[model samples]
Structure formats: structure tokens, C-alpha cells
Target: MKANKETKRLFVGGLGQAISETDLQIQFSRFGEVSDVEIITRKDDQGNPQKIFAYINIKVAEEDLKKCMSVLNKTKWKGGTLQIQLAKESFLHRLAQEREEAKSKKEKSTTGNTNVSEKMGGIDFQMKAVPGTEVPGHKNWVVSKFGRVLPVLHLKNQHKRKISFVICFSE
Candidate 1:
């Protein structure tokens, strides 16, 4: 990934299961000012453990991302391998993608339910959202809210459909 004045963080994925944040910092700190490290985890199709992924935030000039990646790529940690690259886009981009996926899933489920109910004559599925929650409207919201936040919000499966909204302050 191309790194420049606009980029300050990189996402490191395909990590060995045993690697930790401290280990990442130790390995990556040599290039420049290392700020934060985060590991991404999720279950596989069979619900088995999966390789860990991470996002590393650096506090140096953007020019350093390449140097850092060069030093980190093909490096080994905790008996496992490492894949480092400048994070693509911002955290909001990820969140927006997740929201779209959830929306599509919901639509498909509704369609399937309708077809089944027509055939079985007695099947119903209800989905509801709690009160006072803001459902995300568009992908831009993610970029607006999390683009600058170093540790972008983790858009897990559960929060995808809840919508994006902010609580306004009243004086």
C-alpha cells in the first residue's frame, strides 16, 4: 500500500496465533515512533481458532510507513509469520462495508422468510431494534467519526444494523 502524508497507521494481518501487541511493538518500534497495536480475532467457518490480525498506529512522518513495512514484512514472531501493510482507508470504511453486508443479509433473510411462510402456512420471524439507538445512515458517517481516531471503532457483526447516530448535546 502507498503511504504518504495522509497515512499514519498500518494494518498487520496473517499473524501467528501466539503473537501479542508487545511483541509487535518490539519488532516495529525500530523504524519510527510506534503508537499503538491492536489484534483482530474472529472464528472461522467451523468455529475454530483463526490467525490473528492487527492494526499498528505510528506517530511519525508518513514517509516512514514504507520503511516500517520493509522491516516488518517476512519477519517472524512467536514461531509464526507476519504480513504488514499500510491500512487501507480508515476504520469507517470497514464499518460501512460491514453495515452494507448486514443490510443485504437482512434483506435476504426477509425474502427467504416470506417464501417459506408462503409454503409452510405457519412461520414467522421478527426482527427489532432497541429504542434510542442510531442506525448508521451511510458509509460516510464512519469516515467522519472514526477517520481521525487512531484506534478506529471495531465494527463487529452485532453493531452493523443498529444504524449510525450521535447523541446531541443540549444547553
Candidate 2:
């Protein structure tokens, strides 16, 4: 699959069971700034392993990504030929996107509740503050009100001179 412009995650296939995430990270680090690596595996009830692959996220230029894929793809390592390509959107991420879209459509259909609060990904909470309310230490306030804070977005209306905050909670 083609790489999304906003993401630099790569899918690496044909990995031997012996290869670890660190091994892949170290090898790919030479091409770019490796951010995350995960080696996928499935084991049977008897503890015998099956299905081996990996996903690696690297922050690199477009040219560097091409270089990396070209140089490493089909190379023999750890008794398997490496198959490197741009990673597709993860299953969890896709599910979240679909849920978010559904929620958005539902919201548009019904318009009664003034409260603007939503739960995203079953963990993160998005809370919108009432317009024209000033919150001091917004980040700290969110942390104290909620268990943990992920991101706080402040939206201001120029015409109305009103301010609002969209706080996303981690917990």
C-alpha cells in the first residue's frame, strides 16, 4: 500500500521468528529517525510460534524512505528475505476513525444537548468549555478535573470575541 503523506510507518514482512523489535529498529535507524518498532507474532497452544512480521515508524524525508525501502527490500536477513513497504492504517486506528465519523453523523442528526462532550477511542474524552468562560491554567485545570490530560485546544471567535477550549483527556 502507498504511504500516507502524514505518516512514515512501514510494514516489514518475511521476518524470522528469531528477529526482535530491537534488531529491526537498529537496522532501520541508519536510514532515518526510528520512532517505534513492533514485531508481530502468533503462537500456538503448544508454544510453537507462527506468523512473523513487523511494523516500524521512522521520521524521514520522502527521499530517505525510498532509499530505505530500496536498499532493505528483498535483502536476506535472519534466514528470511525482508519485504519492506509503507504500512497501511492500523486496524485500531481505522476503527477509531469509523467510530468518530459515526459519532459526527449522529451529532449532526440530533441537535438538542448543548453540552459538548465526547468519548473518543473509549478512553480519551473531549470536553468543550462554554463560550466566554476564561479558565486559568487550562492544562492544569483539565488535569485536576479529569484524571489525565492529553491535549488542550483553545478556539477563539474573532467576530464574537469569544474563547472556548476543547480539552482531550487521556484517562
Best by lDDT: 2
Lowest lDDT 10-residue stretch of candidate 2: 115-124
Model 2 root mean square deviation, Cα atoms? 15.5
lDDT digits (tens) for residues 99-165 of candidate 2? 6885787568545533223333123333444333334334323432322333446566868675645
Q: What is the C-alpha local distance difference test score of candidate 1?
A: 0.59
lDDT tens digits, residue span 1-171, model 1: 644343267778778777788988887777666778878888899987676788887765555666777776878767666787777766566668766775576467754465422343322222333333223332221222322101123333675654434433222
Best by TM-score: 2
Clash pairs detected, candidate 1: 134-163, 135-162, 135-163, 135-164, 136-163, 136-164
Off by over 4 Å in 2: 1-6, 44-46, 95-171
Superposed by TM-score, candidate 2 places the C-alpha of residue 77 at a distance from the truth, in angstroms, of 0.7
Q: What TM-score does prediction 2 earn?
A: 0.52
